[model samples]
Target: MPPVTERTSSLELPCQDGCVNVSIVVPIFNEEGNVGEFVECVFAALTPTSRAFELIVVDDGSRDASGEMLLRLAAERPWLRPVRLVRNYGQSSALQAGFDRVRGRYVVTLDGDMQNDPFDIPAMLDRLDSDAGIDVISGWREHRQDKALSRRLPSYIANALISRVTGVQLNDYGCALKAYRREVIDRIRLYGELHRFIPSLARDVGARIAEMPVRHHARTHGVSKYGIDRTFRVVLDLMLIVFFMRYRQRPLHAFGGLGLWLAALGVAILSWLGLLKLLGEHIAGRPLLTVGVLLLVVGVQLVVAGLVGELLSRIYHEGRGGAQYHVRDTRN
Candidate 1:
């Protein structure tokens, strides 16, 4: 090993052969008022760990004073690191940028709006130490402090549907507080609002997921970024996730099942006509013929649609140019 050289002028330095234990990744979007308070509480929460940590605040193209606040904090505090994006891509993209730049044994993600309690982070870190099999420890806000109808109601419905469809059995899938091991960063990818479905993605790759109740504080400095129209997107994404999770490797299964249903209807209609012929009845200008023809046509179309779906899935996922990861910012 080389001699440890300490820079007298600088208190903090980049990763020098694994000196840090945890990295906190916060995605900021127009929350300029709360950045200083958030970082202060985060550092106080992690101070008891006896391990060096870095607080990385990713600015997702805020037109407000968020970027300026981050720069100020980075200058005053040695442990504070700020990365800025060119424009506001979204929360998920900002988080992806944070995860890609993590240099710690474990990483924790939290929203910068100060809704998620930083005090609960230590409890999550303790859980990670106990269970070696656990890949991710998600924070479940059993007693959500948000507005009951507008925010809580939709989140409840979406969480129920997500549990039923994905079979992940997580209480609060949309909670912004969660801790992940370093290995999970390579396997799962996030786009759009898909960050809420991280538990499902981990389960797809055979990772054990568990949840514990955490404190939820109502929004203080900024407005709620999500709106009511997100309900439709959640439903649509649920169905797409079900299909991709179940039949990602085999395209024929998804399409073949639909084809069989259509073919069955066509056969049933034809059987009714055959019975009529056997009983010596006229089969001219019958409605059954039209029904059978339509079913057959639809059946063929569905099969063809399935085949097309498979070809596209393979081509896009396998192509080198096609990608899912997005960039918000990075540090040298």
Candidate 2:
């Protein structure tokens, strides 16, 4: 609906002076059965650490009682902040909303299904804080508690494929129990299903990421929002990630390079056809002539597409007042 600028501008950043040590973001969609226990578990887990924390539960327009429960819980717990979306905008959008409102030095994200153990958060935070080099600590569900075929099999395949494609190898890209330094998380803008690729996205912006084994519990309530169909979506999103990783800056290099190859092949084919025509064997009726002509047309179109890509690339970078380079630090 509203543009991101408009949506974010209206919200206030609730934490200043790093008053909040950790901001835990949980995106809920029809998770009424798990909401109360999830909140309590988070509080109980974080309370023992003696670290000030805020729990932001994003209700993604649940048809069930999830929204009402969050509202009731927020009233009782000052630290619990509930964000109600107008309608379900998927997990990525919901996470982005919570990220925009976070007011902590460190940010953590977990599922509202209670499958992610809140108790593991402290260790993740410790790993992040202990290492200056590590910007993100991703959870790896070592012995996952899910069906072999429906969940684990697809997840295993997807994780392997994503790691190989993105070149930021991690055992479990599907685990939502991740911790990030606020700065690292702030640089990322989540959309579509990009939440699953946060580690790879963080790497794109020069973030150092690490993975730690975390406990995964079987779903206690509500059906899994994901299924075998999600594997197809992941593959599509992975293609986007690869394009962004490799061609985000010099898109012309990718498009133009391929375009040039296609154009060259087309030209070669046409030249051969032209030579055959000169040899005079009635080349007008030849199928090769039509194929050559089609290739030439398609090739020209691709090169034109490349030029358009270059223009759009420039606009994207310049419009945002962003550069192709990211500065880690400056001593001057």
Candidate 3:
């Protein structure tokens, strides 16, 4: 888990009178060159809509002048709200901090690097509003502008693998431009690098998700924050998502099932050795006895772990007052 420190606002802000129609959250880290243009682009895209909206830019402890720029921008633009964390807590944490302060019926998230076009916001909002069933509208960069080998190729493979594992079937999990209904997003708790798996996490809670192709631009400032190492991180996070999806409620089923199979195999092996001993064959010096004993011990330990997991699961829900199921709505 990333250290979540106390957040301070660069400007003393007043709360909005009512819930705005839309809230846009962009996580910023060392993007001094793009911050000004990014704000301008967002305002250009949204100002004509005539719908109430707020722009939240979270500065994740940038070593550059990004924080200073945001402070100046927020002071000038009343709608622009800036959040500054004590230190760099990565993108996921910054987004969560922004999400916590959103006062909108609909939420939009995009990267601050300018690769994600803010012009796509209106179309996504339209799609989400016009359709009654869709709860999430994810942007897909079909014509990605990054290098094919170093950037796009690994992302392509990762998106496919994540889709297959989580059963969400999204074409671009890495794309940050996505629109979500407030109710659906409120149910989610962001931590770790799970922001990329938002669509999948929303699906787990019965959200109706859709994807559309959006514009992707080449980076013109600073440098790329990600590298080849990101692929490995994605793989590790994917495994955690799979575990929570399948066995979060009843982890005993996953561990105990494997334990039982190993214990049965161990029993079979030891029983064969006993039969050989009955036939007057030397069995004490055989390696099969040691293998059988090791299997039995490991199998028992796994079963104990399963029991412990069950206890933790109960405590987690009961302590947090969380229910195993979600209620979409209720009526008389």
Candidate 4:
């Protein structure tokens, strides 16, 4: 294996023709046995396609020989770009690293495991090209081949819940075989386990999304990285997505609204207690009064916190030159 030096520093290295038609980004973690076969299969699948493309394989701090294999393969395959992360920062960060380096008109993503078929790329690209209005094409594994009890069942529940909450209905949110137009992908900023929610995030940015059936194969190498625990993580990410979709720009609306409602209820209760006391009704040590006080204090704190969040939001945008809208074009 070649020396595993830091390759991320060369992210800005120039491409031959300034751009490629497609950039395929796959994040791998401890998949040494599958890397070579995966590359061969991808090449076999893509060789017939006339479109110029490059494959970016991200080694997410693999404890095995995956990184070394990637480096070796990259040396032989010029179209293959190897990204070796300093450490395991999770899948989302690895994908972001690849996305930051891609110079292509379309971006394709798939798991490094042999489960997702690379031949499906052409159809996804075809669907994207056919409809100029569609910004994303998500793959739906209509006939999944996985352990029904553990993987498939959890994925089914997650997909349904995500679809209902995000309103971006798709048969398989767990399928990593998806394609996005470069412009649409550029607008997305991934964090946490948000990679699975790309369709939803793209939709939030006004992207027109479509889904198509794709092929799926059982894993041949490496252990599955996901487990039942991912369900809880996905739920948390879903909550974040809901807030981001609705109140990313004006966070106060969410926090302040709830705060005001709680505060009102608290005030009403306290006012009734005060009236009772003024009438000599002896309201001391009442549980309702204690509840009212607690609510009032918490409500005030939430409102203040919301105000602070609003200020921080402004600072974040201004400091980074961020905007609520994206400008595709400007004429002099």
- Best candidate, lDDT: 3
Off by over 4 Å in 3: 1-17
Model 3: pairs clashing at backbone N, Cα or C within 3 Å: none
Sort the predicted structures by lDDT, highest score first: 3, 2, 4, 1
Which of 2 and 3 is the better model by lDDT?
Answer: 3
Superposed by TM-score, candidate 3 places the C-alpha of residue 37 at a distance from the truth, in angstroms, of: 0.9
lDDT of 2 by residue, 61-108 (tens): 999999999998777577889999999999999999999999989999
Q: Write the per-residue lDDT of candidate 4 for residues 78-176, one digit (tens) a residue.
A: 778999998999989999999998988999999878888888888888888888988888988898889657787779889999999988899899999
Regions more than 4 Å wrong, model 2: 1-17
TM-score of 1: 0.82
- Candidate 1 stretches with Cα past 4 Å from truth are 1-14, 76-78, 267-287, 309-332
Distance from true position, residue 142, model 3, in Å? 1.6
Worst lDDT window (10 residues) for model 3?
1-10
Against the true structure, candidate 2 has what lDDT?
0.86
TM-score for every candidate vs. truth?
0.82, 0.92, 0.92, 0.92
Compare candidates 1 and 2 on lDDT and give the better one: 2
lDDT of 2 at 148: 52
